[model samples]
Target: MRSLVQILAAVKELRWYYWGIIICSLLTAATSLLTPFIIKEATDEVVASLQGRGGGISVVLWLAVALLIADLSNTIISNVGGYLGDVMAARLRTRLSQRYFHKLLTLPQRYYDTALTGTVISRLNRSITETTQFMQSASNNFFPMMLTLVASLAITAWYSPWISVMLLVVFPTYMWLTTLTSKRWQKLEAKKNSHVDIAGGRFAEVIGQIRVVKSFVQEKRELASFSDHYDATIGLTRSQSRYWHSMDAARRGAMNLIFFGIHALIFVRTVQGAFTVGVMVLLIQLVNLAKQPAMMMSYLVDTAQRAIAGSRDYFEVMAEEQERDELADPVVGGRRELAPDEPMIEFRDATFGYEDGVDVVHDVSFAIRQGERVAFVGESGGGKTTLVSLLLGLYQLRSGQVRVAGHSIDQTPAELLRGSVGVVFQDASLFSGSIRENISYAHPGASDAEIEQAAREANAHDFIMGFEQGYDTLIGERGLKLSGGQKQRIAVARAMLKDAPILVLDEATSALDSKSERLVQQGLDRLMKGRTSVIIAHRLSTIASVDRIVTLKDGQVDEIGTPEELARSGGIYAELLALQSGSKQDRKKLKNFDITA
Candidate 1:
C-alpha cells in the first residue's frame, strides 16, 4: 500500500480523472443499495395486497423500472470511468518512458560500468509496462473498491444495525486473509520479474554471440539455460495465482455464511411485527446488496496488490536522483559562435572517478593548443580511457578545472558541451539506421550536402556510394553488415558531420587496413587543421605523425614528448615500440594496436 501511494504520486498530474474514477464507483455502490427496497416492495406489499389497493401493482412496477434505469446508468458511468483511467495510464507511461531514455543517455558513464546492458534494457521495458498497469489498475479498481467498502458499510449500518454488524465482522476477516497472504505474493511477483530479466539478459547475450556459440557447438546448452529460467518464472506465476485464488474462495464462502446468519436473525426480529413483511424482504434483498461492495473491494485487492508490487520496482529506477545540472550560468544558442579558430583545451590539476569512494584519475594536468595532436598511450589498466571520458563530460571532475574553448567546462552547459566535443569510441558504435542518418546523427537536421561533405572528409563517401542504395542504404543492427573498417569510417563520418571545434580521437582509425588507414590519415590531418585533438592510442607506430605523445603508465604520465623524443628516453613507450615492431610484427598484435590506437 505504501508503494502504491508512491507510484500514484508520479501520475498526480491527472488528479481529476483519479477522483472521477473513485466517484463513479461510489455511484455504482449507491445505486446497488437502492434496488433492495424495490425488491422488498414487490415481494411484500404488492403481492400481499394484489386485489386490495389498486395502485399496489403500479407502485411495484414503477420501482422496478427505477431500479433498472439506475443499474443501467451505473454500468455506463463505470465503463466511462474505466476508459478515462486507461487514458491517464497511457499518458503517464509515455512521459515516464521518454524520461527514462534521456536519463540513460545523460547518466554518468560510470553508471554503465557496473550496470549490465540487459538489466538496463529490462527496466526500460518490463518495469515501465508494470508501472503503467499499476496506474490503470489503481485508478480503475483500487480506489473505487475502497470507496465502495466504506459506502456500503455506512449504508448497511443505517438499514439494519445488527445484520450490518455481521458484515463488518466478516469483511475484516476476509480482508485480513487477503492482505496477509498478499505479502508472500508480492515477494513472488518480484522474483518472477527477476527471473524474466535474467532470461532476457541471456537471450540478448546468446543472440549477440550466436556465431561464437555455433563455433563452440553449445546451442543445446544455451537452450537449456533459457528453458530453466522460463520454468522458474512459470512456477512463480502459478504460485501467485493460487495465493489469490485461495483468498477469493475464502471470501465467497464467508459471504454465503454471512447471508444465512443475517437472514435467521431478521426472521426472529419480524415474529412480533416489530419488522413489517416488506421490511423483512427488504432486509433480504439488502443482504445480497451488501455483498456488492465487499466483492468489488476484494477484486480491487487482487488488482491493486499485483499492480502496486510491480510499480514499487518500477519506481525504484525512475526515482533515482538525477545528476545535478547546476551551472553558475548556462550558455544558450548554437555552438558555432563559441568556435575557436585555433582552439585550446586545458585540464588544470583535475582529479575524478566514476564513484565516490575511489578516485581513478588523480591530480592530472595537460594542455593542448589548436592544430596540436596529442596521444595518451598506456597499458590496459591505466587511466588513458578515464582521462578521455572525463574530457567528454561522461564523468565529472572531482576537483580542479577542465576548460574547453577557453571557457570553464563546469560553467559550460551540458547540451553546449555535447555539441562542441566530437568523439569516436573504440567499439565503433553505430545504430540501426540509414548510412546517411548515422553520419548526420549529431546534427539531425543537417542537409544532404553537409552529410556528403563530411563523409568525403572522412574518406567514407566513395565506399558509401558503392552501396546499392548509396546514402539511403540501411545498416543492420550495430552495423553488422559492414566490415570493421567500414563501421569505423561511418563513425568517423559522424564526428566529421558534427564539425565541432575540439575532437577526441580514441582510436578512431584503428580498425582500418594500411590503404584505408592512409586515406583516413590524410582526412584526419585535414580535419585537425585548427582544432584541439586528443587521441588515446596504443600503436606507437601511428603517433609518429601526431604533434606530441603523452604516455600513461600505472595511472600517471610515464613520458611526455614527441614519438621520436619519447623513444630516446627508453621508458615504457620505447619498450612497447620495441615489442610491437619486430622482424615480423604479428599482424594480430598490430590489429589490437590499431583497435586501441
Candidate 2:
C-alpha cells in the first residue's frame, strides 16, 4: 500500500494547517502523559501518611494540586487540537473542490462521452466528502491518541521495566491479529467505491434520457437494475460494519488478558514488601490509563489506514494525466481567415479513431473554397459531425492532416483555432441567466449595440423585447421556459455575436417554426455572405445556393459538387435532394432519424 504521504503532498495550499493539525495532536499526547504520574503521586502519598509518616494533610493536599494540573492540561490541549482539526477539514474540502473541479473541466471530451454523468456526480460528491472527513479523523482524536499510547507504554516501563516489556509485546501482537482479520473490509470499500461510480453514472444517464427510456418503456427494468445495485451497496456497508465489530470484540478480549498478566506479575513481586498497598492501587490506575491509550492507538491506526485507503482513491484521480495546453514559444495562435487564393477548409487524407477503436472516420479528402457555403449531406452512419469536429481540431487525426486557411490545425495553437471559428451546434447549450447574458456568453464584453444587432440577425430581437424584463429575463436550464424556436434563435444570436471568420451550422434551424426558420435562415444568409461556412442542412432548398455539396455514405465521401452539377452527375447528392424535395416529411426526415443511430 502506498503511504498517504503522496496524497498529503497534493495540498500545497493548506500545508500550514496540515502541520498545525499534527502538532496540536502531539500537544494533547503530552498533556495525557501527566495523568499516570498524577495518580501515582496521589496514591503513594496517601498510603505513606496513613501508615506511619503523618504529614498527611500537606502530602494529600500536594497530590490534589497535581491532579488539578493534569485536568487543566487535558482540557486546554484537547480544545487546541479540536480547533486545528476543524481548520484542516475546512481547508481540505476547499482544496478538493479546487483540484477536482478544474480537472473535470480540462478532461478531454472523449472521457465524458463514455462516462455516466451520475457516476461522475457521485465521485465528486462522495469521494470529495470522504477525503475531507479523512483530514479530521486522522488529525483530531486519532493523532493525539497514538502519541499518548506510545508515551504511556514508555512511562509504564520507567515504573516497572518488566511490566512495560509485557505491554509492548501485547500491543503489537493485538494490532497484527486485528489487522489480519479486517483485511476483507479494506478491499471491500475500494470495490464498493468503483461500483457506486458506475451505478451512479448509469442512473444519471437513464434519467437524462428519460424521454427515450419512456419511449422504449424500460422504466421497470431500469428501476430494478438500480435497486439491485443499491442492495449490493448496502450489503457491502453491512459487511464492513461486521468486520470492524468482530475486530473490536477480539481487541477487548486482548485487553482483559493483558490485565490478567499484569496481576500475575504483581503477585510474584508482592513478597518483597518494597511496594505499598497504595502503590498497588496506583499501579492499577496507571495500567488502566495505559490500556486506554493502547486501545486508542489501535483506533488511531485504523483511522489512518482508512484515510490512506480513501486517499488512494483521490490520488487515482489526480494521477490521470491532464491535457496541458501545448502552445509553446510561438505566442501567435491559429487565426481563422481566408488564404490568398485557395480553399478555406481542407482535409488531406485524414484519419481518426475514438477510444473505442471503432474508426468512426477513415481516410478522407475534401476542401471548401473561400466565400463558399458547403453542406455535408449524408445518410445514416455517415460522419458529418465527426468531419466537422476534425476540421475544428477537436480530435487530432491519427494519420493525415486537416488545415484551415491553408494552416495545419495540428501545428496551430488551440486558442487561435477556437478564436477563429463560431459554431451553432444541434444541442446548443444555454446558460441559466438573462437573455443578454446568455447571448453574450462567448464574448462577455460585447457592447449593447453589437448584442442587439446580433439578436436582430438571429431574428430573435422582437420576441426578446416583448418580455416584460426584455433581455434581463432568465431562460432557466437549457431554456426550458422558452419555446423550441426561441431557444434555437437565442443560440443563433449567441453565435452571431462572436462574428468569427468561419461559421458552422449543424442543424441550426431544426428546432425553429417555419416562419422563424425563414427569418433565421435569412439572418444566417447574411452571416455567411463572405465567410467560409460549413453547414449540415436537412432542407433541400437551403443548400440550393451553396457552392458545393459533399455526399457521405458510411463514413466515405461519395460525391462532391454544386447542386446542379451533382444532380447532373446523378450521384448520392442528387438522390438525397430528390427525396428532400418531395415532401416536408420525406426521405430527408428518415435520414435525420438515422443520424443518431
Against the hidden reference, what TM-scores do the models get? 0.87, 0.87
Clashing pairs in 1: 537-597
Model 1 bad stretches (over 4 Å): 48-51, 54-61, 141-149, 234-256, 267-281, 296-299, 328-343, 351-360, 397-401, 406-411, 585-597
Can you list the residue pairs that collide in candidate 2? 119-200, 119-201
The number of clashing residue pairs in model 1 is 1
Q: Write candidate 1's Cα lDDT for 255-297 as tens digits.
A: 7788788889889888967676778877766665556656766
State the lDDT of candidate 2 residue by residue for 340-452, as single tens digits: 88677888888778875877777789988777889888875688888877777667678888988787877776667767788887666787889999899889999999889
Distance from true location, Cα of 341 in model 2, Å: 4.4
Of candidate 2, the 10-residue stretch with the lowest lDDT total is 328-337
Q: Note each model's CA RMSD in angstroms.
A: 3.5, 3.4
